[model samples]
Target chain A: MNPKFYRSHVLICTGTGCVSSGSNNIKSRLTAKLEESGLQDEVKVVETGCHGFCEKGPIVIVYPEGVFYCQVEADDINEIVEEHLLKGRVVERLLYTELGTEKKIPAYSEIDFYKKQHRIVLANCGRINPESIKEYIAVGGYEACGKALTEMTPEEVIAEVKKSGLRGRGGAGFPTGLKWEFTRQTPGDKKYVICNADEGDPGAFMDRSLLEGDPHRIIEGMIIAAYAIGADEGYIYVRAEYPLAIRRLEIALEQAREYGFLGENIFGSGFNFDLKIKKGAGAFVCGEETALMASIEGKRGMPRPKPPFPSVSGLWGKPTNINNVETFGNVPDIIRNGADAYRAIGTEKSTGTKVFALTGKINNTGLVEVPMGMTLREIIYDIGGGVSNGGKLKAVQIGGPSGGCIPADLLDLPIDYESLQEAGAMMGSGGMVVMDETTCMVDVARFFLQFTQSESCGKCTPCREGTKRMLEILDRICSGEGREGDLELLEELGDHIVSTSLCQLGGSAPNPVLSTLKYFREEYEAHIKDKRCPANVCAGMSAAYVIDPETCIGCTACTRVCPTGAISGERKQPHVINSQLCISCGACAEKCPVGAIAQG
Target chain B: MKSLEELRKLRAELEKELAARNSEGKPKIIIGMGTCGIAAGAREILQAVLQELEKRNLDVITTQTGCIGMCEQEPLLDVELPGKERITYGKVTPKDVERIIVEHVVNGNVVEDLAIARLEEGGI
Candidate 1:
């Protein structure tokens, strides 16, 4: 044992959010202060992963007291070292205050954002130093891998996973154990296991955080999966955009190799497994399994028909088992603690937890892992602290561009795989973007279609042509040039694309348009019929701005600020805006002294 | 590296290093590290106490405090378990650190030979 102990441990978040906010400087400054105060031996500084309260980044937490500090700057390091680390008095100004209340929360666990979260996948994310494999081992990291390899047979491992009701968390809710069983039972001289860390969904960073925070956990999960499925070689297909995740994963793999966790070894049980990382060139379609396999095989990343699924003929024409990063992250926990323990956490069907990257117009924008079947309301209001800027929530865009928009009326809906699919949204690798009343639903549909349309691999006609057509109609609608029956045309095209597309990329591409049309159809109608955007987001289609003469003070604020010089009035007199010259910029409306602007 | 025993040994070896990071609700051993206490050799006592806890694999929080107006017994050590009254040992040398941790922190028995004062249920 090292036999070294510190009175206090200061864990500074070095996750991407915190690093971008200059946490590295704060860390160095803190180290310098500790050395200056001669408390270097007594106070240990640890760099951790994302704390998930990223809206207040540069988070610092001192253990033995668990004082939670947020938005810490380099200058604040002196106060933390002097007041908290030295004198044992918490710096009151740096504590995380409750969203609506003035009460300061010092402890990390007691915060409302972290209290509602059940962190199984993200258990070690912000708690440990990610760079140290020793810290990972001390937290019981690879014990499950050792247990699976040394004690249990491959059949027993697969049986336990099956009994746990573990499903694939990579958007599709396929049973993971069944996939493993297929790959294990297949006849092949050599087999392969691929971890799909190529998370390409817009607004989703669950896999990146897991890879950056606990790369060893994912590697351990892969080792167990490889042993279960009788695979000797594995590859992690992560996108190249995630440099930090890749670096951490590289470090972890080297450390695991050094510890005999990887390579032809096996606690002397005679099993051989090694992994290599394949970086995808940032293609959204490569997230699909076949496309990912094709990319790994040094071919163009495009999906082929299934039926001869990866379990039968996968990478390099061998039997392969592919699972998502999060799906694999759950394996070690399920094996260590029995299947019943894993099944007990979530609903009967969707067992265990799901990690969602909560973003958009929410008060707390970060990552959150909640148990399956948790209500959207609980995730949005209880954990996310409701919509941002006290705005009314209009809808939530779940599952990325391939997913759908859920209206405010469905806020109480329990978020399970089946329920999300029933609401026309697949639980897409867990991206929950809350939209406020100021958001235009028609534009939201257009935004997602634009993303999917641009990311389409163009392998099939339905996805290529169909998405183009839908996006064109959406474009026309938002630009105030929409014709009647455009909504019906979009629905027909969406159904055709969903039914005829070759891969899931094309199949689910029209989800945003179809789901938004299903829920907020009236908004689309208003765009076409009234020639107006109710939310005033579409600059071309927004209702014309007019000065309310009765309330206009003619303070000349509007006239001086208007770029078009449309407002004409005298001092203390009512102003009149030239409608033709107004341009609907709303600058005059914002600049008006009195409440005198109206959309006419 | 070839067997489960190796992994377990590795885990056991590093477990004590992380014990200090998770010391909520655990018994606390506070060493008076004030200027006067440091002059009386309090830093050595803190090191000895931490080493003993690590050797025995105990979960205890060790902290430092300024002097409490008892410079005569400068190197003071206080042990306060959860819901237990605080026990302070005065004039503590590096040699007495292990016995105090074993008796007061682990076994819940105060060392009578080094008895000094008893505070209320709460800790500083």
Candidate 2:
């Protein structure tokens, strides 16, 4: 008998998802309470990494009796402590209620969200202490590099990747093995492996989280790729915007070098590989492969034409293998586990899981990696926990500015590279922003176009001139000056820009305009024909707020908080908004004591 | 510098620990102390659980886990009983420690209203 020493374990989620939601405070409070109650010595509290089911956070598990709690709040703490801790009674109200059932689940594994997920790349993400190198090593972190260095030849390594059917996750679904083979076969003495960490796509943080949660895994993956391609040096081109990820990566690299996993004849293998970090100056265009390489060379980040693709002649006029943070992160797993094992997860063509930074109007707005064939419905509904604020799902923007908007009708479509492209959207760097019915499609199109227009290098006439013209037209339309031929003019200019642009940045710049036109033509018609923004998102088309006489509670909260001196009324009387002076900032609506304010 | 074989051995050892506890009738409790949980007072609940078990000298093991969704609920706790069902308690407080110990552990009867949900077979 193990002395009958108190038999329960409390597992707390220390993943980024929970951290953002204030899990740290909960941990500290629980610790203080346990110590005060003299219950600290028996049960041990361990802070683990991310659990894939990020929708329900600040999750706590009581062992021996698997009790699962969802949406745990601080105010409800004492009840939990008194009812469950002291009395050894499970707290039923705090239990996670299944969608259709009264059955309260007590274990993490029983949740439907967790059951479907086969976590591979993200296996250790939520399970270990991210800051501790020993914990990473304890989970076979650098073993894949060891296996590749000691056992597999360069060709064999490439062959395994080729067999796995892993594709580039940085927007374009280029085959990873094919890209490596190209660099390997290229006759260049100074081959380089570059990790594209300049994740500038709006609302995308998959790369950042992966680096923050498990930086060593990416390093291990890169080392394997460097060995496979016979590259002597590697560079991680990350944006300066991600200070945390950059710091973590630097630490991880130092740890790897110290452990003999990086730099000079790694793992006793004859192959020597070293990694360097290059900071990007936050240019959106720098996400392009050529621009990323140029930035590393201490030049202004700008895209160059293809045909001298990075694999053949890139980075100081030498052969280079450029894989994004996600692509490299998958390499170690492919080698550690067999390629056949990976190939079994995703669709036949697009094998393995793809990581997405699920954002916008989704309930579970965090990092998610699912098999390639998982439908948008599963991602948005089951994993993302449906549209946020109980709003109707309108559209999903995939692949950032370079990708297109996918309407809700195509929510059931499998989320493979080809399927997304077929639905007029691309898997551009795994940024999936779920938009709701309140979003204005016309406004959405304008926003992305403005981004690309500003980010364009202006090296090409088509993209520079064409994008500017389209943006001007969009601005006019958004400002309620749109004419009947404006939509046609946008399509014509978009086609011209896409056809004649120098590189992918410029080439795919018109995707947002083209896609929004393809799906939400009515919105465009309303903007041009009816001159009204249906979603009330376009500020130019929206009217100022006015208080209804019946609902006004005579509270001066709205009048007091209004930034503009637009509302005028005596106390205890309904206020009338002067439209000329009104800014339509919605401060009055928010400050309204009674629900009297309405905006058109 | 540890070799690949050494790293593999370490991994195997860690995995062994994770798998070893389930062999016994002792129940395992996993506390969600993810970033969200920690922010929501998970640390307090964690300490409370430990102190309670230590005071009673009960044979329960406590481990830390990650987020299980439901961001609205923080400081979540999962309790597994031997030969019986698993229950999750949400919004746990240090003050609730005494009640949990008395009603759940010694009595073998669960506090149903506060229990988040019950676990199915083979569900950890």
Candidate 3:
């Protein structure tokens, strides 16, 4: 062996967030510096996957001494090389300053943001060479599959998963082990396992990141599932929007097949399994398991009623087991590490860590995985680095269209199946969109309702007509034309739609509307009673601009920027905005230089 | 192309080599080369480090890794000098490479100002 060569390893984030921030230039500059200094021989640099802390990227870490450097720029390279690399001194200014304390911490793991996170499904995500099959193998990649094939029987493998209490990471928190068992016990000559990668929620990218960062892990998980369920073929129903994820999945499939872990696999044990990629056309409705299966079958994606859930009969009328990218991603770990180890991490009901695409007003806007029982406040403030812009927290929207908005008052609620359900929200595919005080609650409800309304397949009248009518009421209320009973109508219609719709797409469509009504009813009442939007978010209810004479120089800057000629004033005088002609596009507010514009 | 058994044997050999190195006090240096890291120019820095080590015939091993979430600082370096301390150098450039080797690796003295942080008694 080459005598212990380099003393330290440096990991730089190359995930999507860092790539957009010019991480590549920093890599080249670092290489050039290292070579010139002749430390290239003693030092090593490796670019790894996303390390989850996206708020302060592009991130850099040095380990076995884990020193985290945040928001470093290209010009800072010389100081790092000259002072730290050569003189062994840390640049304190470049260190990540914790929110409450001014003290500079060195190690990456000790940072409060990562201390609470339990990374299981994301174990190898930011740590390994994702593209290198050799590196994956070196880290005991296929060992789980080998063990499953060589040692354990299919029944025993299934039993272990059942004991682990693993649930589907896909929006609906169904039991993964039970789903597999149902497909296994069902009467069918040919069975299949489908991994859903068509993650369509607005703020969700957990599935995409998993596929890109650790494609092999998902593949291995699928293979294990296939072996357990007697599945001969598998399909990864990925969305066409994720080109990077698709490329990685294809590469991973090829590598798995080459290793004999897939495609007539055997560790001297007879079991056959193969996986294929099926791209979705980016329809939000296709995220539904039934519609997703239909899309895979070369049919116009649409949902079919239950009783014969995917486990009983699905995907070309076979006993098919459907699991999302995250669910499949967990299989290998569960198998290799044992069920008890996996179960020991999370709450009694919801076992293991959950991957969340924490976006919107949160400081850390990338993917994060915390244990099941972690409170929303912990996720937002502790793991997510708190709200961005130091804005006051208002509400959080969990579970996308199928879920509801949780108010700030309930921020301390622990995130689990039962707790979130009781709080009028479901952990829908782990999409946590944090909102600040500036966000209008009524507008938030309307936005999600609009999303579901447009994406509805229009198959049943309750969903098709109910969503349309609900959206119209929301629009009227937001536009200040709401009647005295508009709120009652919304609540009544929302319940009707939720109870009468055909599939989950229709059934859960009214969550956003109902949840907002339940929590922010006053905002709705204000639109009708006071003819105003409390947060000044509604386009129709809010006026364009009110000039503050104290600050306005009468430069007519607002008039010039306004698309409409609503502002009238001479040069160097305070302008008067004509509300009759103002469109409330906020152009005048944006163009105001002296901080004279106000909108309400 | 090799048979499955042959591939397995080769994998075993590589594992053995890795295990032996890990057991010894020879600190292993991993370079982030994920898509984010590569896009950030980690490839070039990785090559430079390997070439420099080859020229000096140092008893160090180099490997590529994935992103570590700090994309702003690409081509990052982690130095685990034997018996001393492990330091993370960020925003590294090619011009500063030679000085790192001469000052840190050869002299048994670590460059202070450039380091992002030092791994102390407990892991970071």
Which residue runs of candidate 2 sit more than 4 Å off their true CA positions?
A1-17, A24-104, A542-600, B1-3, B16-124
TM-score of 3: 0.82
Against the true structure, whose lDDT is highest? 1
| Model 2 C-alpha lDDT per residue in residues A1-600, reported as the tens digit of each score | 123344445666766667777778778887877788666765556565666456677777665455667677666566665556644557888887766466787766686566666677777775555665766876777878899999999999999999999999898999999999999999978899999998988877788777777888888888888888889999998888777678777887888787777878677777788899988899988888998899889898888889899889999989999998889889888998989988999999999998887889987666778999999999888878788888999999999999999999998999999998888889988888899989999888889988989999889999998999999999998888899899999999999999999888889999999999999999988988887788988875777678898999778887788777778888888778888787777889988866789884
Candidate 2's docking class is incorrect
iRMS (Å) per candidate:
2.8, 9.3, 9.5
Each model's TM-score, in the order given?
0.95, 0.78, 0.82
Top candidate when judged by DockQ against the true structure:
1
Better of 2 and 3 by lDDT: 2
lDDT of 3 at A125: 74
lDDT of 1 by residue, A244-268 (tens): 9999999999999988899987778
lDDT by residue for model 3 over A1-600, one digit each (tens)? 433345455567777677678777788888899889866855567766777777788887654446788887888777766555543456788898877786787877788877888898888776765776766776777878887877798899999999999998886789988888899999887999999888988778888878877889998898889889999999999999888788877887888777777776456577888889999999988988888898888888888888688888898989899999999888999999999999998899999989988889977777889999989999999888888889989899999888898999998998998888888888888889999988888888889888988999887898988999998988898888999999998889888888887788888889988888899888889999988888878887875567877888998878888888989988987789888888788888888877788874
Candidate 3 runs further than 4 Å off: A1-8, A28-44, A73-93, A543-563, A567-577, A582-600, B1-124
Q: Which ten residues in a row have the lowest lDDT in candidate 1 chain B?
A: B15-24
Interface RMSD of 2: 9.3
Model 2 TM-score (B-chain only) = 0.75
> What RMSD value applies to candidate 1?
2.5
Please report the TM-score between candidate 1 and the true structure.
0.95
